[model samples]
Target: MNRQAQAAVMFLLGAALLHAGATDLYLRYVKAGLQPLLLASGAVLIAAALATAWYERKRTRAAKAASASASASGTGAGHTHPEPRISWLLLLPLLSLILIAPPALGSYSALRAGTALQKPYALGTLPAGDPVPLSVVDYASRAAYGQGRSLHGRSVRVTGFLALDRTGTPYLVRMALNCCAADAQPVKIALAGKLPPVLQPDAWLEVTGTYSPKATHDPVNGGPIPYLSVTSAKPVPTPHDPYDETWNN
Candidate 1:
């Protein structure tokens, strides 16, 4: 790749980053908190690319003038500096971003990480609301450590991707991000009952269910994972924000 090609790559990358930041796509990979930073970085990168292009153009013009003067003075411009070639490998990531910006992490990642019981929260009482809408993290915490005692008689709606293990055990998994996808952690909620056979792993679903008191709680270290008794499972499109932001802190 010549200087122009290298500059073009930089410009494309910067534009891609900016596009990701400006759209809902960035939320798929990272928290909304980083949007401003991403936008700033993209803008800076584009500006830097523009500046570099300008500098290179100016330098090339100067080199031509110098070479012309030297040639006129009866001396050949000592071999012009060779243009550098950028490796083609640099295009892979940019192509990936352009062609297929991957969706948020799914069952493959969730299964690899497995699921852990949530730590106990000291909230004296569960938050007020009927059919209390809660994050998988919150539901897991209350179910595991609180022994479903707090969630008793409460109808709740939990949304996440459906993941099934080799044993055919189904789980609703949601990833929580602290800063970015790099620090993402999976929170899994086991779902009971026969789900639609057509539903493949990583299929997003909104499960309205109640916590089973039968779920064994390991208070020692919150070891035993919890389960939910699914009342109704409905297919839903991927959420605008796929991650559970409750645990982002």
Candidate 2:
């Protein structure tokens, strides 16, 4: 590839990265904490692109001046620079990012093996609120390791996509990210009652339910997981930030 083409590609890549980081698009794939790094890298790439252009322009001008002087003296021979083919693969990622704009990890991603639930922090008094909002990761932690004792009488709310186990048992599931989607782990809760007829896999919903600490088998990992006795549920639009990060209070 010629220097110009390489420089252009770099610029495009940087711009795409900057755009993703500056906007909410990045949150879908990784934690929001990466924004600053993304932006800095993008700026560096753009600066490098500009430097490449300037250096190429100066070299071109110098070559032109030398050729003109030699031609005037009728003593110069033609000089040629080899051009190499640029692989089409170079454009694939940029095009994909611009056109498709891939979504974050979802149900299919959650189904992958080797993923496990994230460990929760030390327990504290339940946060204030009736049917308080609780993350799937938090609920799972309190349910299994806490012996379901901490959540015995408290009603909590959780939001996640609808899914079904092999036995067709309905449940709520969410993938929490430790870094990016590559390390995302799925946290699930079995819904204790019938769900609305229209519910489908990947359909986002918020449910208000009580935690049942009764010992139960975890279909995903074959260990104990928390269960929710769902009292009420409703469809909700997919949240802009889909991941539950450890740093959140």
**Candidate that scores best on lDDT:** 1
Q: Write the per-residue lDDT of candidate 2 for residues 207-232, one digit (tens) a residue.
A: 99887755466655675556788888
Candidate 2: how many backbone clashes?
0
Model 1: colliding residue pairs: none
Worst 10 residues of 2 by lDDT: 111-120
Encode model 1's per-residue lDDT on 1-249: one tens digit a residue.
766677888899999999999999788778988999999988988888888888889989998999899989999667656654448789999998878867789988887774544464463576788788888888888887777888898989989998877778788889888788887878888788646667689999988888886553222233455889888888999998888867533
lDDT of 1: 0.80
Q: Which stretches of candidate 1 lie over 4 Å from their true place?
A: 81-86, 116-125, 193-199, 216-223
All-Cα superposition RMSD per candidate: 3.2, 2.4
Overall lDDT per candidate, in order of appearance: 0.80, 0.76
Candidate 2, position 147, lDDT = 68
Taking all chains together, each candidate's TM-score versus the true structure is 0.85, 0.89
